[model samples]
Structures are given as C-alpha cells and as structure tokens.
Target: MFSLRARDAMSASWAVSLLSKSLTGFSFWIVGTGAASAHVKWFCAYDAAGQPRGLENVLCRDFELLLGVALLWFFSGCVVERTSLGELLVRSINRVTEGLRLHTEVMIRAVCGFFFISLWAVGGIILTPELKTTSPQVGLLQLAIAAGLLSRRTMPFSAAGIVVLFGLAVRDYGTFHLADYPIFLGLAAYLALTGLQKDLFGVPPLDVVRYATAVTLMWASVEKWAYPEWSFPLLIEHPGITLGFDNEFYMRAAGMVEFTLAFALAWTPLVRRVAAAMLLGMFISACFEFGWLDVIGHSGIIVVLVAILADDRPREAEYRAPWLAPAGLCAALTVTLFTYYVGHAAMFNTSIL
Candidate 1:
C-alpha cells in the first residue's frame, strides 16, 4: 500500500509540471503572433522612454493601463465563470432575456448597434496605420467635444459620434481610423435628449446596450482570429504602431475583453458599470492622444446633462431642445467634412481634385 501511494504522488507532481509548461507556452504563442498582439504592443506596451513628457505620454500611459486592466479583467472572468454561482446566474439571465418584450429588445438592439460601431473603431485602430499618426491636438479636441456632448441633456451623443465619425472619415479618407469620439458622444447625447436616459436608468433591461455591444464584439473577435493577416500582426509592423498596446496580441485581447465584458454584463449588473467606465476611459485617452479634447468635453457634458435631467424627472417639453440639437448636429457634420477634406485632399488631388 505504501509503495503504491508513493507512485501515485509522483505521477500527480509530474502531471502538474507538464500542465504548467503547457500554459506558459500557450500564453507566449497568443501574445507573440498576430494583429491582436501587435495592437497590444501599440496601445499597451510601446516604448516611449526618450519621448517628451507632455499630453502624448500621459495619453500613452492611460491606454497602457487600460489594456492591462482589461487583460486582468479577462482572467478574472475565467475564474468567475468556473464557479458554480456564476453558472447559475448565467442560466437565470438567459431565461430573463428570452422573456423580454419587443420594446425592450429594440432598446437593447440600439445600444448594441452603438457598441459594434465602437468595435469597428477599435478594429480600425489596429488595421490602419494612418490613424496611429493622429496628432495630439486632434485627440484633445475630440475629448473636449465628447465631454461637452455628454453633459448636454438635449443633445444626442450617438448622433454626435456619428457626425464626428463622418468628420474623421473625411479627415482620413481611404484610411481605417478607429476614432470613438463621434459614436460615443453622439449616442450618449441622443439618450440625454430623448428622455430615454431616465426611462432606462436603474431598470433591469438597461443591460440591452451592453449585451448588444458584446454580441458584435464577439463576432468581430472571431473575424480577427479567422483573418490573422488583417489582424494585429499586420498592424504591429505598420509604421504607425505608436502605443505599447498597439500590437496584434494586445488588440485581440482587447477585443476579447470587450466581448467578454458585454456578455458578463448581461449576466450581472455589477460589471455593466465597470464596462461603461472602461469605455469612457478609452474615449478620454483618445481625446488626449489626438488633441481632440473637444470630443471628451462634449461627450461628458451630454452624460452629465442626462444624469441631471433624469434625476429631476423633467417633462418632455423641458427635455426637448429643438434648435440647439440640430445646430450641434450640423456643426458636427461640417467639422467632419472639413476634417475629411484636410485628411484626404492629397488623395483627391491625385485623383480628381
């Protein structure tokens, strides 16, 4: 009996050692190969030792930390999912979703649509080097704009974000730029103005936004994995990989994080707020990096306005800002066109301009 027990113990120890090696090897492979890893390098781990300490470094550090937190959150999710309680909660949530009404579904879909749009922005960052060349002025200016929109009760941030996106598309025509200022600001502003901010706050169905975002992110992630060339590997080697986390591995991991968070929030409200904060943090970082501080300011203003108006439970009449809303939206559109012209004038000149 004693001899048999000793042999079993020895076998178990060997098995554990082998498992450890396998895990380490797997991690290395995940980070060392592809566009996600390259994205990770640009946004999370890029070296900036000799660079001047200004808005640029601050922006880089924030993104690096953001990526690191996302990675940690991903690992923590694995632990959570492995628990019995997590399994139970997940099944219960699925049941709830199955029973939701059409209105609830529409609201969910809208939120999700925005989230996927954000993913496209992130993907653009990884795949297009030109976006990586964004100037600090641009980032800060956007941030300011986002903040302002977020604080405005009558503004639609989603519309604003779309407008901003149009601006960016114009600014860098033919280049894939993943700027989120336009979308986030636009969506948030819309919610604030439409009285929906109060309608959904503290409700169980509020998770529709996150769930929708997650679904899009999950598919996007699969596509990234399926097409490794267009993934992080190509991105990392691109001349524009500026941030540490701008590598293929990291970008993939970020996508994974977004996907996981979206699902996790669907299961638990606790994580929903965290996910929102992460999204906001990313936007803030972008504002500084491109000197698009206006985006940050405008987006933030809209959010605040929504929060205040929501708490006050103001009448629909008070919430409606007919003139300003359209004006802000038109202004956003004009800026987008101007920026696009600046970014693509060269190409246009080469072709037909």
Candidate 2:
C-alpha cells in the first residue's frame, strides 16, 4: 500500500510539472508573438504592391478553427458585459482611473508632443520605421507639429500637419501600405475636433478614434493571413518566438488574437477597457524587444489606448443586446477580409483568387 501511494504521488508530480511547462510555453508564445507586433516590414522585406497569398490558401482549417475560437471569446465577453459582475468591474476600474480620466486629453496632447519630437529627432523616418525618406524638410515638419501641440489653439494646425504627413506617406508608400495605419487619420481627426471644441457631428472625437483603431487593427490582422510569409524572416531570425510551434500556425493565432482584441475595443465599457489594457500591455512588451523605434512608432496608439482605459463613460446600450457583438465580429471579419483582398487586387492589378 505504501509503494502504491508513492507511485501515485510520483505520477501526480509529473503531471503538475508538465502542466507548469505548458503554461510557461503558452505565456512565452503570447509575449513573443505580441513583441512581433512591431511592423514586420521594419524587420522584413515586403512589397506593398506585390500579390498576396490567395484567399483559398489563407482560409485553411487552422484559420477557421481560430476564427471560431475568437468568435466564442468575443461572445463570452459580450455576455459578461450584461452581468452584474461586469458592472462591478467597471465601477472598480472607474474608481481607480477617476483622476486619469479628467486629464486624458492632456495626457494625449503631451504624448503626441513627445511622439512628434521623437520623429524629428530620428529624422528621415516618415511616421514609422518602414516609411523612410532622406528629406530634411520632413524632419522640420515633424518639429513644427510638435510645436503646434504646445497649445490647444494651435492643436488644429498640428492635426492638419499630421494629415499632411500621412498623405505624403501614402503618396510614397501607396494606400495598401498606409492602410495599416488608419489610426493616424483617427488621431488627426480627434486632435482637430477636440481642439475646436467639437465632435464628429454627434459622435465624440475619441469614439471616432476607437472605431478607427478597430479598423486599423482588423485590417492589419488580415495582412497576417494574406502575408504570413512577410513575417517568416522575422520568425527565422527569432525562432524562440514560436515557442516550438510552426511559423504559419503561430502567425494565424497571432492574427486571430489581434482581430478579436481589436473587435473588443468597440465593445461594451468593461470589455473595451480590458481590451485596451491588454493591447497597451502587448505594445509595451514589444517595446522591450524592439527598443526605441517600437516605442516611438507605437506611442500614438499607446496614448490613445490609455485614454480609452481611462474613459469611464456609461455604455448601458452596449450590454442591452449581448448577442449582437458576436454577430458583429463575424460581419467585421468578413468585410475586412473582403475589402483587403479586393482592394489589394484592384490597386496592384494582381489576381487575388
């Protein structure tokens, strides 16, 4: 009987050890994949106009499985939003963030100032790492944008400068490349509208930003499905990131995770706040691996996320119909994928199949 008990204890210990290792590997997978969120174009060779993988190739069994999982996760969150527990979470968060919420706009302005200054300091970079230029004038424009952010009165000018810079980037990089960053346009609109003490018709400027952020992330996630090969080089260089998973599978999982989290940003208050916090953490974690470029490139979005987290506004309407969120997620996935594939085909005159 003593020997039998000893054998059972050994078996239980082995199982626990295995479970611990599995959990550790899963954490590393998430962190490593999140760290790669730094634009792959920065670390890998990519042609914005090149033909992407066909939809048939991208919509594999693995992709479908992940999509189903993401849908379930989103639906679960929505269902939670209607619960008293969600409200309690929201209230707790609001209480903690009350001070921050009041100064959210100020925080954004300060961060934007720092971001533009960093761009000026770096020089030759057009908005992000991949969008490089040798023009000295662009650096000066960045400085000017930073200066404009000094005052609310001149913030509109700063916003206009951001739009101008985005246009320049689009002209140089093409719309397909620029589509990865609709958040810039969203920021510009937010800055301009907020500076002028106005909202987009009836919608708040920050809400416009939320929608744009969702669109940007959803669109970029599709890129992972369409161009997972673009990140192959990075995976080869940093194999540890895969945590022993196949590169293709890892990329598919990353894309699905990003898409689901992005969709959550426009969800009910508790859900969105949690999504914002997770994204912010992911971006920050990436910065540890990619360094200053990652920090500067992602600063704008990071600040926007902070503001989202700090936002304590009531959103009872969102929880009223919890079922709609999963349906919306499905619709959003279809539309974004369709738009990306068809738009790329039209722009590059390439076959999308």
Candidate 3:
C-alpha cells in the first residue's frame, strides 16, 4: 500500500486512498488544535483532566524552531545560485526554466503547495476563534488538506490545494463574504488545472485542473443566479462609486451575462481567455469601488492568467518568453480599478428597502 509503482492501475487508486487518509489525519489534528486553543492559552492545560505539564508545550515550541530552521535551509538553496548572486541568478533561472521537464515542474508545484498548506495551518491556529464559532469553514480547511496530499500527480488535487489555501487565507483576514469565496474558488480551479498540465502543444489533456476550474466557474455562475443580490447590482453599477444599481433590470441582465460567461469558460479552453479578460475587468472595477490596493493577492491571479497565455504558446514560435508572467501581473495592477464599479449602481440605493 505504501509503494508507488510507475505502471500499475491499482497504484493510482491506492495513492488516492492513502492521500485521503493523510488529509483526514491532518484535518482532525487541525480541528482538535482549534478546539483546544479556544479554551486554553498556548502553554496552559487544555482541559480539566489535563495539568499544566509544560513538557508538551516546550516540545511543540522546540519542534517549531527546528522546523523553521529546516525550511530556511531548503528555501535559501532555491533562492541562491552557486557563483552568481546578482544578474547571473536571473539569467541562470531564465536559462534553466526554458527546459523544465514535467516531473521537475510537478516537484516545484508540490513545494509551492506545501508552503501554502503550511501557511494555512499556521493561520488556522491563529484564527481559532473565528473557526471555532463558524464550523462550516472547517470543511474548506479539510478540503485543502486533502487536496494538498492528493496533488502528487493529479490536477484536481492541485486545484483543491490552491482553493483551500485561498479559502483559509481569506477567512483568516475576515473576508467571509459570499462573493469572495467564489472568486477564490475560481482561482483555485484555474491553478489546479493549469499547474498539472505541463504539456500544451494542442488541446492540453483536460485533467483535474481543467475539470476543477470548469466546475467552480459553473457552480459560481449557478450560485450567482440563485442569489441575485450578489450579481445584479454590481453588473450595472456606477462607474466610479459603490452606489449600487438604480435599475434592477440592468443588474439582473449583468448577472445573466456573468453567469453565462462563467459556464462558457468551463466547456471550452478558448473561453478561458474570455474568462481571464472578464476577471481582469472585474479586478479593475474592484479597485475603483474599494481602494483595497492588495497587489499581492491581485497579482497572484494575474500570474495565473499569464501562465495560461504562456501555456498556449504555438509550437512554431521562436524563443518563447516566460517574462509574460510578471508583465501580466504589472499590467493587472495598473488596470485593477476598471473592475471596481461593476455593481456600483446597487451599493447606495436604499429605495428598494
């Protein structure tokens, strides 16, 4: 059960099962920790039956210190090259990146996924209060843990991992609004589908990542339709303000368009470009409505968009570029305000009340 065979069909099945078990174990640990943290201080007794046996506390602290040290060692190597610490590092990365094999790419994704999972774990520990009170969110946490474990070779797992991480981070920062979850879910779907598919000469193998993205986009569209409040007003909002929709019909029409496009994105890869474009529009609109200026999160999605574009490169093209990754990101930041007023027409209209 522990062995990984390169050829056997059972191997995939077994791996998924084991991965599920591992995820469940981590989920239970997180839930238990969250529950315990709610009542007691970090180093104090967790229950009436338990004593202030500082041994467990000390051991946990020591373990954390060691883990930090080990992570630094591994990450520093990824950052630093052998002889060149300046321009050479950039050139070296670019040169080597031109020929990255599928396995190597998967490994890189796994490393990134692990880093994200670690962040979620730490964040959850800190945000125990919010999680303890709102139990449904724990399902998202569990889903993330499971996805991280299953990300071995499948795109679905990768999608799950990315979405779960986003979910955890959003919740930690107190962004539990319903609209935000779907956006994050959409992003997670994009990441998972694109991350696993390393080869894209033609119609790239529609694996888990693609499937996940399709599911999320379609589901989100369905949800938006079901909850007109989240979709309608924003569609016909004022250009630069959060004034909400003056006309209900305009908002509803906009919702229909968003819903339709989201579904279209699922059925065909060509629609991904359209989806990316729409999302970019929405991001820009968001900036106008609320000067959030959270470039980090915003840029992350843009990176994925750029990655998708890069992946769609033609085989005949000469010297394909990877810098498009950062270019899309910078461009998105500049245009983020465009998406701000999407539902602006509905923001301040109290007449409906």
Tell me the TM-score of each prediction against the true structure. 0.33, 0.89, 0.35
Alpha carbon lDDT of residue 260, candidate 3? 34
Q: After superposition, how far is residue 43 of candidate 2 from its true place, in Å?
A: 1.7
With a 3 Å backbone cut-off (N, CA, C), the pairs that clash in candidate 2 are: none
Of 2 and 3, the candidate ahead on TM-score is: 2
Output the TM-score of candidate 3: 0.35
The candidate scoring highest on lDDT is 2
lDDT of 1 by residue, 287-350 (tens): 4443332242224322322222122111233222223333332343334334433443343342
Model 2 per-residue lDDT tens digits across residues 221-292: 888888889999878877877767788877887887788888888877888898887788878977887788
lDDT of each: 0.37, 0.83, 0.36
Instruction: Give the poorly placed runs of model 1, Cα more than 4 Å off.
Output: 1-153, 157-197, 200-216, 231-258, 271-353
Error of 3 at 192 (Å): 8.4
> Which portions of model 3 miss their true places by more than 4 Å?
1-207, 230-247, 267-271, 287-303, 313-353
